[model samples]
Target: MRTIHAPRLLLLLGTSLVVRFGQTLRSEDRERGDVPGWVMITLMSATLVAFILVMAQGALESMFNAAMEKVNP
Candidate 1:
């Protein structure tokens, strides 16, 4: 009898489960009549912009402070 490759078998099983989960999510979204493409795109874009702004907040504050100090001196 041949020995089983446990690691390879587990990896294949995990991949299959993930694919099936994605398919199920897609089907549910279709059934729910999900939001339109344009709306989704707008929402995603806004989220990205918000994230960028948040990440840059500290840098913006430092730049503003530097400019003010120069102007006041």
Candidate 2:
């Protein structure tokens, strides 16, 4: 059995997060109520922190292990 690595997985995950965040911002703009710049900034910052804490570390580790398995197997 093989496992994934770390750096490559983190880079991939970070890229995906940026893309998702962009989509979310676009969706927020389309909502009926207008979002003030400050509020939007605050929300985005908070969401980013939450994403980092909740997903980035663990997910990247798991992805790396999976990738390693594929490569070695």
Candidate 3:
């Protein structure tokens, strides 16, 4: 009579499931069409511009205040 180690059996089952899931995801990704190059470029450019504007917002506010003070004073 042979006895199976329950922990080892569970580990093997879990590993096989993860492998299968990864393979399925890879296959699906292969089947999907890639995003257009221009779309990605535009999205990246917009993101960079937004980040720059957000980072410089404080400086912009101070510049605007200085200009306003010069005009008023």
Candidate 4:
């Protein structure tokens, strides 16, 4: 429906613009600041979040494959 699609399109456009602006600001800030602690915390958090997501994805894929094999065979 138009109503559902219009909001989703607007949300996607808004998020893209915000992400671009934030990327520019982050690059500028990295050059201007020597906040080692803040950078380390951000990097550590990102690493942990990525690790969790990857593990979750692998587990889900395994479970789905097992289910599919059982169902098909």
**Which one is best on TM-score?**
3
**Poorly placed runs, candidate 1 (over 4 Å):** 1-35, 68-73
- Per residue, candidate 2 scores C-alpha lDDT tens digits across 47-73 of 566557555778889999999999995
* Colliding residue pairs in candidate 1: none
Give the TM-score (vs. native) of candidate 4.
0.34
lDDT of 3 by residue, 16-68 (tens): 55565455556646544544434445554555566566668899999999999
Q: How high is the CA lDDT of each candidate model?
A: 0.60, 0.63, 0.60, 0.60
Indicate the TM-score of model 2.
0.35
TM-score of 1: 0.41
Give TM-scores for every candidate, taking all chains together and pairing residue i with residue i. Answer: 0.41, 0.35, 0.43, 0.34
Q: Local error of candidate 3 at 30, Å?
A: 14
**Candidate 1 C-alpha error for residue 35, in Å:** 7.6
User: lDDT score, residue 18, model 1?
Assistant: 56
Runs off by more than 4 Å, candidate 3: 1-35, 71-73
